[model samples]
Target: MSKDVQERGLEIRKSVLGAEYVEAAFRSADDFNLPMQELVTEYCWGAVWGRETLSLKTRSMLNLAMIATLNRPHELRLHVRGALRNGVSKDEIREIFMQVAVYAGVPAGVDAFRLAREVFDADKDA
Candidate 1:
């Protein structure tokens, strides 16, 4: 992987996910998961999110919809925080989950909403 791409990815990842979170993620990575961390930072964040085509807000919104559809609770929670950081409003998130309910099934929507609320509440307390 290009060092530039990896650097770009780390920058974007820290911006969207917060520096502390990204640092913690790296700090916790063992040999087993270090490569995955590097790949996500370089490719997922740098190669994809670093693109200029879409605004970060738009990307976060899309992620919310897709992750919700996939029913990936952990990622959904993480991205909910990222969405807020990327300027996605709680109202917009609600609408996305509602759309997911229609197309991805009510159960998925329910879980998405629940997870999003948990993030919101946690942020409030923090």
Candidate 2:
């Protein structure tokens, strides 16, 4: 990774993702997954996402759509919550999922909605 990208990426990840979350993710990961996690931080978050072409807001919604289309409920849920930290609103999240349904199918939407409700429920009690 470029020095600038690495510096900016760490700042972006820390600011948007929160240091505690990033630290937790790092601490919880084993040696086998270390490179995979670092690569994602260095490339996915550091390279593609760290670009100034689009705001993190746009990226968050896009990620939500992609995760939903791929039926990655776990990742989708993580991003749904992450979206808020990325400046995506709850209503915006619903709309993002709605758009995803149009291209990815109704089932994808049904699952996303169910997941949304669960997250919201857990968030409420938290």
Candidate 3:
């Protein structure tokens, strides 16, 4: 990818995930994992998220459902926070999980709710 794409990705990633979180991710990257980080920043955040066809709020909601369906609690938790930052309401998130329960499985919905709650509680404590 071009330097411009990478820079845009980094900016968007930081805006969505928080500058501290993105900086820490880069800070902890080793030789083995650095490439993975670069790919995620450049491709996932820049190439995909940079597109203006869909709003960031829409993307965050879609990510929440897909990540929940895939049973990725870590990514789900991160995206839950991002979702809120992107203006996705808690009620909307609950509805998304409820939909996940119907199609994806009750277990997936349960885990998504639990992870979301953890993120919510952590923010409260912070």
Q: How many pairs collide in each candidate, listed in order?
A: 0, 0, 0
How do all models score by TM-score? 0.97, 0.88, 0.98
Cα lDDT of model 1 by residue, 83-113, tens digit: 9999999999999999999999999999999
Q: What is the C-alpha RMSD of each candidate to the true structure, in Å?
A: 0.8, 1.6, 0.7
Worst 10 residues of 1 by lDDT: 12-21
lDDT of 2 by residue, 22-62 (tens): 77888999989988878777787879888899999899888
Error of 2 at 109 (Å): 0.6
Q: What is the C-alpha lDDT of each candidate?
A: 0.95, 0.83, 0.95
lDDT of the structure predicted as candidate 1: 0.95
Order of quality (lDDT): 3, 1, 2
TM-score of model 1 (CA atoms) = 0.97
Candidate with better TM-score, 2 vs 3: 3
Q: Which portions of model 3 miss their true places by more than 4 Å?
A: none
Please write out the lDDT profile of model 3 over residues 1-126, one tens digit for every residue. Answer: 799889999999999999999999999999999999999999999999998999999999999999999999888989999999999999999999999999999999999999999999999999
